[model samples]
Target: MYFEKIDSLNDLKKLSIEQLKILADEMREVLLLKLSSHGGHIGPNLGTVELIIAMHYVFNSPIDQFVFDVSHQSYVHKMLTGRKQSFLEARHYDDVSGFTNPDESEHDLFCIGHTSTSISLACGLMKARDLRQEKNNIVAVIGDGSLSGGEAYEGMNNVVEVGTNMIVIVNDNEMSIAENHGGIYQNLKLLRDSKGKAECNFFEALGFEYFYIENGHDMNELVTTLKKVKDVEHPVVVHVHTIKGKGFKFAEENKEMYHAGPPFDRKSGKYIYPLDNPESYPAVTAAFLMEQIKKNPKVAVLNSGTPGGFGMNAEWRKEAGSQYIDVGIAEEHAVAMASGMAKNGVVPVLNVYSTFLQRAYDQLSQDLCINENPAVILVYLASVYGMNDKTHVGIFDIVMLGNMPNIVYLAPTCVEEHFAMLKWAMTQREHPVAIRVPAKEFISSGKEDTTDYNKLNKFAVTRHGRDVAIIALGDFYTIGRDVADKLKAECNMDVTLINPKFISGLDTALLDSLKKDHKLVVTLEDGVLEGGFGQKIASYYGTSDMKVKNYGIKNSFPDRYNVEELLIENGITVEKIAEDMEKIIG
Candidate 1:
């Protein structure tokens, strides 16, 4: 009744704390109902139900910017902002995106779904407010996982140094998509769990005004905290302790499973249709590699704070215990630490997102690549079609890692091939190997499924034809195959599908061969068009002789995504690619 009656944030101020708590309960029910049916970031939205309410009631929106780090938690904020209907009914394609979008509502300051970006974005907003001489409170609601990022630290340092007027709410649920990783949260946990008597505060050391709220779920406590800090001068970190997946018993119990998920049975709290193929890339790779580490004591799994998501969940963590080192959300530190481990005869497989690896570019180039540390850096979801916000697009990794002197970038088109790439990277002793496991299923390629580390130079051509060379980098390899088959069946055209296993650079011989027979070469990737593996292929073969078409993400900031739509937009659709091939040939 509370939620049905009150549809907007304005109605929030009218309700008492107890009334607001009822609304939170109703909001939680709606989130669970829709997410259990449609599926999305269930735990995150459930956790932030009251926090966003507290935020809206505390700060004036449109004027006072509320920037959320990895804005998936902003669903509650959207609901209170009068966008609940969109989430409940039209969740997939409706106006209300899971993440923050300025276009969706005036309350959303920035369209961010990636972690560790709120502080920097908030600082920018604060600077803009200063220049305009506008009176608006800029509040950044960031997770503890985000604080492990270098960008958050940079922003915090800058804000402190410059004396910017902003409120940085560290929504410390001790959880990211999986259970939260990193030293920052560890320190904060000690601080909160010990009732502020805990020593060695990272925030105070970094010159930030610190206020730790032990109870984040208590609506009254949240309101009091926010009210106390409203429009307060200078930057401050209101480290609020909250439980992720709160209210939902299953979600609360199994934090990792409920982080971000598929449609689940509401009562049973079980996934409706089991992902017949649960992503085996990360887990299998971990299983196979972690086996090697356990066999040989020198091997270690280095996590930049996402080991659980990397398939080394609590069970593995308990099994590996200290062997699977989660270096927190610090990618830079993770990379550097891996390099150090490698230098001392230890094998380190640092699994991180392709996009998040940007933070460790300098370390990768200087520390690991320069010394030729033969570590395995498992780069997951390297392509642009990643459904997360633009800030998390690891699409630029091909170009960024391409120029690295002693690094080999393996773009595995299949899940089995990803393990093969992992095995190969594990064997290399001279230089580091960065394996990119694209978002695609690995069809059974019956060829000796084992890795051939020595033959790292060779590239696999999936199929052969002459009309048009359909080049696919990683996951798009199958997409290319499907398109090529469709073209052959429909248009009386034989198309070649090339799976360039190595996206770092093109196989010159194969590229040169395509020129003579292929009428058109269409390079497809799930990354950015400007600087991607596809564009690299275009540049390599787009000489006057070859008519190469580059299909990828356009030069623009991507909005919140519909996965299928994103692929279609990037020209990754089978029908779309087949149609394009037909038109070009005709």
Candidate 2:
């Protein structure tokens, strides 16, 4: 009722503190009402309502930059930034992205979904503004869960060292997709419980001006604290304490469930989809790893701050004991730490998403790949496009990981291959392996795997077709299969389908065995086209007499469109492939 009259941020900013508190309540109700139908990160957004309002009211957005780490909390930002109506009726519509998108609104400085990137991006924006001689302040709103990320630490360390004029708001609601892990949680708890007094001084240790506030939900305190921090001359970290799922009883009870989700019953707090057959990578992977760690005492599991997000459960912690170490969200430390753990005789398995893996690229290349540490990096949602508008498109890992020496890239199209690769990767003692597990369903078969992947550079051919060769990478194999089936059934053309399980070291044997009669070779991957697996294929066929076309995501993407449409637009079409093959043969 309050927000109905309040259409703009200006109207919101004009409200009194009492009115602002009530506005937060109204916004929470509105969000729960809308998202119950569409499903979203209601708990995180609900908890952030007041803080987002305070940020908008105090800081001039679209001019003064605001970056939300993981960006799930941006739902309140979206409401205040004038995308509320789109959120209500047409939620899944292209206009209202789930994450922050600079293109969507200047209010959303960055479109990011992954964790631990706010500080780095914010620091970059600040530096860019300085180079251009711009005067606007750059603010990064990161959560305690995000602060666990090594990139955030590196970014904060860099920002502090350089002594820039910026505001880093630490939204310490004490959760990151799931209950956070590592020493930071203990430190955050200590500081959060501090009533208007400072404790631990974590950021202060990093050469940052630190200010800790007790209650982030209190609009007066939030605004007042922010105003005080904004007056400071150097880069500072403002630690604000807030509740996760502050209002909703169910969300408060189950903070993890409400982290980010689809629509649910507001009163019941139960999800629209019953907890049966949930589509999750972490749970599946963690469940399987528990089985492995039980069998092999030497096998261990690692996570950044996302132990819970990556599906590390209490049973594993209880059973595996110290074998399961959540390295916080510090991906760089997690990777290097896993390498060290392996050097000491433990087979460490690091479960991380492909996008977040970018933060530890240098460590992955220099520390593990160079020395050939035999650690297993299980990458979920690899080569991803727009799952959410957040800064988490993991489309670059395939291109990046494949080129790294002494590292094997395994793209498992289904669950059997997924678990199979996981098992194989854990036992290896020579080279580091990164498995690309796409967010598609698992194709499970009861068949046991007795195969040894000593030579990981191999491709699996699903079908034997003569006209055209469709080289599919990772989960993109399924999409290519659909295209191949369309070519076979619709146009009666036999299309060869090859799943290059190994992304980096392509099967030169398979490529060498290609027949001249098999006229057209099309490579399909889910990563960026340039410097991606498809381009690698184009490079493979560059000097040869083979005709090649590369298909994947192109250069820059900042919008939500049909995934199938994206493939078609990129020329990985069923009809187009059929027509091209027919022409080539004729």
Separately for all candidates shown, the number of backbone clashes (residues 3 or more apart, or on different chains) is: 4, 14
Tell me the spans in candidate 1 whose CA falls farther than 4 Å from its real position. Answer: 88-93, 180-182, 197-200, 275-279, 384-394, 449-456, 461-470, 479-497, 513-522, 541-544, 556-586
The residue-by-residue lDDT of candidate 2 on 65-93, one tens digit each, is: 88888887888888888777775566444
What's the distance in Å from true for residue 419, model 1? Answer: 3.5
What TM-score, over all chains together, does every model reach? 0.88, 0.89
| Model 2 spans > 4 angstroms off | 60-65, 88-94, 120-138, 158-165, 196-200, 206-210, 234-236, 274-284, 308-310, 383-390, 445-451, 465-467, 479-495
Per-residue alpha-carbon lDDT of candidate 1 for residues 296-399, written as tens digits (9 for 90 to 100): 77778887766655677777778886678876677888999899899888888888888778878899998988998888888887765454565566667766
Top lDDT hit: 2
Q: lDDT of each prediction vs. the true structure?
A: 0.77, 0.78
lDDT of 1 at 548: 77
